[model samples]
Target: MTLAIETFHYRLAHPGYCAIPGAHPGQMVGSGQLFKRHESLLASPDPRRLDLRASLLDPFNHYRVKVFQQHSKIDVLVIADLSASMSIPGGATKLQIAADFLLSCAQSAFESGDNFGFIGCGHGIEKKWLFPKGLRMGRVQELARDLSRVRSGQGGNGLFQVEPYLPLRRSLVFLLSDFHFDLNRLSRLAGLFGRHAVVPLVLWDPAEYADLPEWGIVKFQDSENRRTRTLLMRPGLKRKIIEAYEQRRDRLRHGLRSKGAEPVFIEGRYEASALTNYFLQRVV
Candidate 1:
């Protein structure tokens, strides 16, 4: 679907933007950057930024002042899951959905003048999957190209590997994944990300649970191992399969909440408007 994406504003404890004088230039609730056009000398009153034109034009040269854009930029990171389960057949794969989400987020970040980075986690932290901090609008195009060739790999434990590279200060992190890993393992990983503002983007496909024939001998293949198993899809078994997915969803949501992170569940397709709403709703 044609999706409408929007950028959002979020308050952070640190987000690397401080009011105090810092080495890095960023948007924050801090004192930095000089404003153009001297409206009031009482504000900037900077002798260095004295606007001679306005000073000469002023009837009394009493209101010459400089204006400044006083917004701090925060880093935004997108951590995507590249595990085999994300490559499920018969629908837009999880990676495809994740790529779209990342693109939308990148657009939002750029519009807000924030830096954006990306980490595609699969089988471990591969060098190819790391997109370092960048702020240009073209960064999203590069990310999209990289994602176009990426497929779900056998790696499933990459989430735990992300903690080391996380931003030192508080940041807005969006983690996209199907989360088919061990519950205990996922919980621990969530705790690691709890240090920052983490939003888990849980991707699920209805076909993964609801497309099985009511009665048939279906051969299911494991994406990671490439192993196949035949199971009779009886009516009772179908119901159980669907129920299990529902339970899994609940656990994933609860786990994130318990760890001080929020979870957004996206089923089948990725809708930019819905994603935007999730961010807006969480603005408290």
Candidate 2:
């Protein structure tokens, strides 16, 4: 049953985001180098630009993203998956990292003279979608404020209701999700890519990558569904589980490639620069 998404007016700006600990001067590379790594951005990565982008990270938090705007008339939409699963034990759950990334990107867009907005979705049809376009920094503040308070519940994959909202503009979209959801409805990704430059960020925790568990039998509850299930892990079972996971990953990759949508794997545990580098250096 599809329920109408109650669209409420939520503002942006997070007190915590501002107070988030700052980084030391020499701990990281120059920001211009980060952007320059992506050939599509600037001629070179200037240290000055790197300083601003690098500040998005909390000195204590390792998850950080840098957003740059090279095109106007083009949009930069940040969609974060806020499913219940993202609330698990971790410094910054995939959801939080995504949210922070969006905030950082909004700031970058504002600086680059492009319009930006954000959408947070979970297991339902309705979503807290914000489409703040044009050269408006207020939108960034609105996005930050609204996202800080979002909560997630388990339900259907976010792919269903997302189709109607595609190509909000002939702009670029960054959809970040744990991606442990359904894939049959992946056509929406294809459609979004067809119209706009879209990238599907498959966010996965290290634990999710390899179903690691202590020796004893432990009952595990579904992240999306609270139901608990027992699994006896034999060598054969473990192999099958790992193989199935790999196959699913490959399938999604193939599906997106078929649709012309670039799929990037994002490991939530460590800093993965492959995709970000691709975004920054590959496209011209």
Best by lDDT: 1
Superposed Cα deviation of residue 197, candidate 1 (Å): 0.4
Query: lDDT (0-100) at residue 130 of candidate 2?
Result: 36
Candidate 1 per-residue C-alpha lDDT over 100-174 given as tens digits, one digit per residue, 9 for 90 to 100: 777778887776667789887888888877875774656666666667557645677777888888777667888
lDDT of 1: 0.73
Task: Please report, in order, the local distance difference test score of every candidate based on alpha carbons.
Answer: 0.73, 0.54
lDDT of 2 by residue, 177-252 (tens): 7666677767655666676666677777665436555344655667777888887756666667678888988998
Worst 10 residues of 1 by lDDT: 21-30
Instruction: Please identify model 1 stretches exceeding 4 Å from their true place.
Output: 1-70
Q: Candidate 2: how large is its RMSD?
A: 15.8
Misplaced by over 4 Å in model 2 are 1-73, 123-127, 132-151, 166-168, 209-211, 233-236, 269-275
* Clash totals in order: 12, 16
Candidate 2 local Cα displacement, residue 43, angstroms:
32
Reference-based TM-score of each model: 0.77, 0.63
